[model samples]
Target: MNEVQTIDELVISFENHLRSLQRSRFTIRQYWQTWKPLKIFISANNIEFFDITVGKQFIKSKLGAYEYANLNQMQRRLVNTVDALSVFQQTGKIHFGSAPLRRNPPKVFTGEIGILMEGYINFRKTTFGLAKSTANNNIRSLYTLFLFLEDKGVQKIDDISEVYILFFIKNLNPSTLSVNHSTLGVVKGFLKYAYEEKVFSTDWSKIIQRTNYKGQPKLPSFFSTDEIKSILNSIDRSNSSGKRDYAMILLAIKLGMRVSDIAGLKFEDIDWDKHVLTFTQFKTKKSITLPLLPEIGNAIIDYLKYARAVSDESHCFLQQLSPYKKVTAEDVSRVARFYIHRSGISLKERKHGAHALRHSFASELLGNKTSLPVISEALGHGHTSSTMFYLRIDINQLRQCALDVSLVPSTFYQQKGGFVS
Candidate 1:
């Protein structure tokens, strides 16, 4: 094979490799599209051979040039593209790691403590069958605890004391209620495991005070009917991107599918003759079959027939650009936000993303006098309580359910005169 001399050649080679791997057209297109900026930057700066160092410098230079929303997206895309390129240059094949951890592992998780943490993570996965995200979270919490233990001059797992655990809790950021709760729960579990395994003679977990962080439930954000209509109408359906986005928004509002489910949708998931969409939900891992609304079906058909890029990948949705691949949940959110921004709809403290569409779907059903259980089923929620949050936004229904306080008679004593019943 000829030596890959330019970024264009490298991209072409990578695109072919992705195609061979049956990667979605959208994925290939997005990867290539993101690489275009780096290609340009390299040409302008006379930089040859793209690597981590050059990628960082390029990112640093372009930090403030883009809008806040696009800046993070661009940075992530660029970093991922550069990393892929670096790997491909070394192996002459496309290989990437799993999703990056939300927070970097603390320094203390490097030595003996690290080994213990790894064992705990494996135990969480194999023994308890916890999800990958949950296991990673537990690992993160343990890492934090280990960092605290290190600071206290405590060397091993056996040396852990209640005072050190209490000190860790005391030093936790007060504003981070969610983090503190998760960390404390994970620490408790760790202590229990250590005790059972005979690593610690005493189980200190039982003594660690629980962080009382039962925050008041806030109302979920949702768009009104008019707002949803306005946002949907804002999409310029004349273009390929418009058609794809319109279909995605319709799925969110009509079917109440999560962004991940939408992004992961495949051709086989849709039953055209039966007029049903069936797929496993991303988060809940439950198979759900939703009636395919005629409008949604038609929108999808229009995109698939005319707008969708040609690719062997089975995913229904693909990026319109070159090297097309399956869209991500983040991509779905960006599409929603793009239209919401253009439509001039004020989210008003509600989440301003595709999830908001789901919220709106439940709210609409509730407004139409739909039962909570039915609404929960439609939303693919495992429990009705998961759907209860929507009730907080249903003002009319709440009013109807409100109890008459005046019916309860209260005996009172007159202030200046005499006792009155």
Candidate 2:
């Protein structure tokens, strides 16, 4: 899209969109007629782009003291048009004839600080090619600093310094070193952007740098062999949903497929002849093929034959209920959680998601003295380091690592009240 768009251009595009939606000729004409007032307003003000802020002002000027839901037909038409244009610009989607959308534009910024915040977010997205979610995370980290500057009467970005930076860092709630490091990186990057743009004079990016975090990650959750069996048994398997879920659980426990990979399973990803399954791993984007265990293949066959939803979607798993949508990664995880709870397993301090099943699968292999490299390959881990996370759950291996007591002083063990005297 062009960096700058005129009002007329947007309206023309919106008209094409309305036709694509298969709106009736008369309905499209009605929407087109409503666009005139907005066009006139944008022209009079010389707006280069029709943003939500301008849209709100247009509604106030045209409607002139009107209730939201209580608007007359003429007022409603104009408000909906503005709402549609606003939605089109922000999301590239039409929301025609929706008052609630016009009333509530997402997160409007009013002051200089808010304006700067908006710029930072836009720059981060455009320059770094960050996804919307990643950009939101950067905002989450930097918003506190923005507020701190405001509270300190530091209106100009020029006032930011080592002292203010230090103070802001001090007030943050203590978190893991990793979390703290991520937050610091965000602050430093924002400062770099500000300096390069001449919004702030100081080059404060040098104030913070990334460092390796040495702490061990907490042990991952896994079920015992019995607990895994119990979870599998909890499913009734009498109905379609039960049958569908049983197949899903087997994929996790038996193959150690990630929830995403399992939910995204396609019929073509399986080889009925060779007894193998192949699919691209979602997180790593690397393709992996695993031997399709006869039990897992059979379970999948049972689901496809009896219980699977009749969806046109190529994905193998689908919701049991109407609409019969393809199951999402969340859907699969929720299935795991549901049966884990029903199995009457103690979930205290243990993750009960599909991922825990993956952990259990690895731990089971480790218990059987499966080599780490072999287990790593079965888990489709790109590196053994990733597979090593499951090693902490092997209590016997950890016991072997326990320090030998041969070097300890004999006096330390014999010490008592009599020895002290």
Candidate 3:
């Protein structure tokens, strides 16, 4: 049989394997999707799985086509192909497959970081049960670090010295990218974790200290109470999508959840009787339970009962169009952006996107004199320092405590050249 027929057989056999493993229908479909490209790429090249060198060559050729941003996705698909080949080999489903992909573990220098990344990826997949975007983010960060190390001529975990980290930090431009303190913190955390775990003995933390410059702190762009009212008013909730959009926007504002968390929400995540919503945070690898406030619960209930589309998909949010599927992270951002524009907000502030609603929630809480720890927990942040960022944006609360005084005192008015001048 030709390549197409061979691929079909492979897919059939893989589906059987997946079914045997008790994989969900959605996941089985994703596996087929991941496999199709590899089969097509191989067929076009007139190669069989037994020719491991050809597969390796094809992977290398395609590597250049993917830019830095897309390499992780391409790599994942390639990895999956390797996994499928392994399954075929073990099950006697295909005789020509060699499973050339070694699945080399990751570390700091000697490809150990790849192993480090895989640990995080597996944790996200199994423990936290994060959605694809979050797992992708955590994986991407580790991959980027590996790429950085490769560029620096550090090929093993032991090679990652304090000097190398210092150089990386010093060379990073925080202003243009707007990723100064946050990037530093991520790197510091990773290194510290690695060091303390004895994955690497080097004290990279001492060299890659947090910058004292403070850089330009980003003021979290959140809607003021009045602005929130105006934005909500702009939503035309008579239509189905309007109702759904309104519900989503309201949910974020009221609960202080990330857009990723909202998009990944399922029906089972919410508890009506207990007035609670529970889910695992993808970023921090922690399970969280939040009390479903009356307003949020009511909004979601209304949407599910009236506005939500009928679909087999378990996700709470779905696309408005036919063959409706789960709403993506991009969809969340786009919907929020559209309304932000409609509300006559500045374009500069629109970059905050759906996340601004969460920030708005935190700001409002801080304004109400809520403790930082409380706000941090509500926002699912691992540290209070992260939530403290919103405290600066609570200008209304600050105004209440400020001592109002005339700038020009009577004593200063008498001496024109003394103080006023």
Candidate 4:
């Protein structure tokens, strides 16, 4: 590796690399500012290579002088710099440690288990043609399993017993059915693969029972109509960020578009003349088209014409700050949360993310007696069953399904108070 002659050169190269990756200019500037102090410390000490010892010394020196806030900020920046340097030195590639999915498992699992995990991930991708997100989840699940094994001092895959598997299952959050089911599903899939590959003598997959979680159809948490209105009103449409957020929230509430789809929305997806919006569902991969309500269309137009940052990128929503890349799903959620918080609407038993807006949309439609199939189509649900859960919250519809107790014999009702013949 070519040694960085000067910290200035390294900073320049890192800044350029960040720009190449389309990192926001604000982020790049922050990184640069953070590195400046480190540069001074390194140059003063004549540190040749940035290593853990240098990092420790830098922290130790600054911890006493810097204020709490400044010190916290410096620590984060230093860690980011170290990560960037390490990646560059090892792979000859510039990575900002932004992609969690691309990260490898803990170093302890780098032996036999790691090889098997890699092979299993490849098998899932090539054999099953699973989505990148799904494959990533599977790999992460195996990593968790191996991490647990390492913690318990079991190194080899052959040494893994049913007791270890049961212990792992027991450790999962029992209240969270989805997490338990998904984790167990991935582990079992890996075990089956291992058995087929002769890594295990017996089919341990068969021994690991599926999670027996027959959970009730829980009502989807959503804001009330007034709360939704308050959230929308809370956004300061006078600014670019507010305008963008207002449009994104409308898309979620009016159309029930998933956060992912809203983040991935492009200019071409909307036809103003036709008053239609179309996009492929991120989760289901199904193409869906919906009528562009005047309210939603107007919000989007205000954002596009007045507020959206000028960028060559085609994504409908761009970050307010420089680099101005497309907004991510997490960004969409944050926007929702910010407005919801600003609105001062206290949510006790409901989610406050962008998805709550989606649930609100579904609840509104169901309240208006919209057919399940129509609501399903509107929400871009791949199956009507996916939409059925929303019905659990439709009290009016549920009331309609209730049996008319008034028709029952008086003897049947009065028998509890006094025995009636």
For 77-109, candidate 3 gives per-residue lDDT tens digits of: 665465555446445443333343534334332
Best by TM-score: 1
List model 4 lDDT by residue over 1-421, tens digit each: 4454355665566677777889997888777666778888998998876644465467546532121222244454665565565455445467744622123324334778778888888888888678667876786677778767776778887888889887877765444566557778888999999999999998889866866765455667888899988998898988888889999999999999888999999989999899998887787677999999999999999999999877899999999888998999999999888898899999887678888888889888877777777887898877777677654645567554344466777668767556775
State which candidate, 1 or 4, has the greater TM-score.
Answer: 1
lDDT of each: 0.76, 0.77, 0.68, 0.75
Worst 10 residues of 1 by lDDT: 63-72
What is candidate 3's CA lDDT for residue 92? 45
> What is the per-residue lDDT of model 2 for residues 19-78, given as tens digits with 9 covering 90 to 100?
898889998888778777678887888787877778887886764333344455666677
Clashing pairs in 2: none
Model 3 deviation from the true structure expressed as Cα RMSD, one decimal place: 13.0
**Reference-based lDDT, residue 172, model 1:** 70
How many residue-pair clashes does candidate 3 contain? 12
Angstrom error of the Cα, residue 46, model 4: value is 37
- Model 1, 1-421: lDDT tens digits are 3244467777778788888999998888888776888888989999766554565566546541121222245556765676676667557766556322111223446666667777777888887667556876786778778766775778776677888877887877555577768888998988888789887889888976776676436777788989988998899999999999999999999888888999999999999899999998877778899999999999999998989999998998998777999998889999988998899887667788887888889888877777666777899988766666544635567544344566533554333466562
Local error of candidate 2 at residue 310 (angstroms): 1.4
Deviating ranges (above 4 Å) for candidate 1: 1-108, 127-133, 389-421
